[model samples]
Target: MENYNKLKSLVASIEADADKFFNNGNSAAGTRVRKGLQDIKTLAQEIRNEVTSKKNDEKK
Candidate 1:
């Protein structure tokens, strides 16, 4: 549950940064957006692994 909330927050930040870069044409926002996206991808992979691990354990 906590991780889920963190993921939501990261998603929100990514959207905000994208808006700043695309809508406002702020160059600095682009860097932030890229970083946020990377963070999200890493986190998503971690969560996926955790879920898969649990499923595998259950089957064992």
Candidate 2:
């Protein structure tokens, strides 16, 4: 749950950079957005693994 909240916050934090990169023409913001996306991907994978682990545990 904590990590889920962190994921949401992380996305929220990246929103401004995403907007600047997409709606405007900010190269630096684009770089930040890309880095944020990579972080999001890694976090999402962690969340996936956690969910899978919890589910398997419940099966016992």
Reference-based lDDT, residue 41, model 1: 92
**Candidate 1 per-residue C-alpha lDDT over 1-60 given as tens digits, one digit per residue, 9 for 90 to 100:** 567778899999789879999999999999999999999999888888888998999999
- Cα deviation at 23, candidate 2, in Å, is 1.5
lDDT of 2 by residue, 4-38 (tens): 99999999999999999999999999999999999
Give the Cα lDDT of each candidate: 0.89, 0.96
Error of 2 at 16 (Å): 0.5
Model 2 segments beyond 4 Å from truth?
A: none
Instruction: Name the 10 consecutive residues with the lowest summed lDDT in model 2.
Output: 1-10
Off by over 4 Å in 1: none
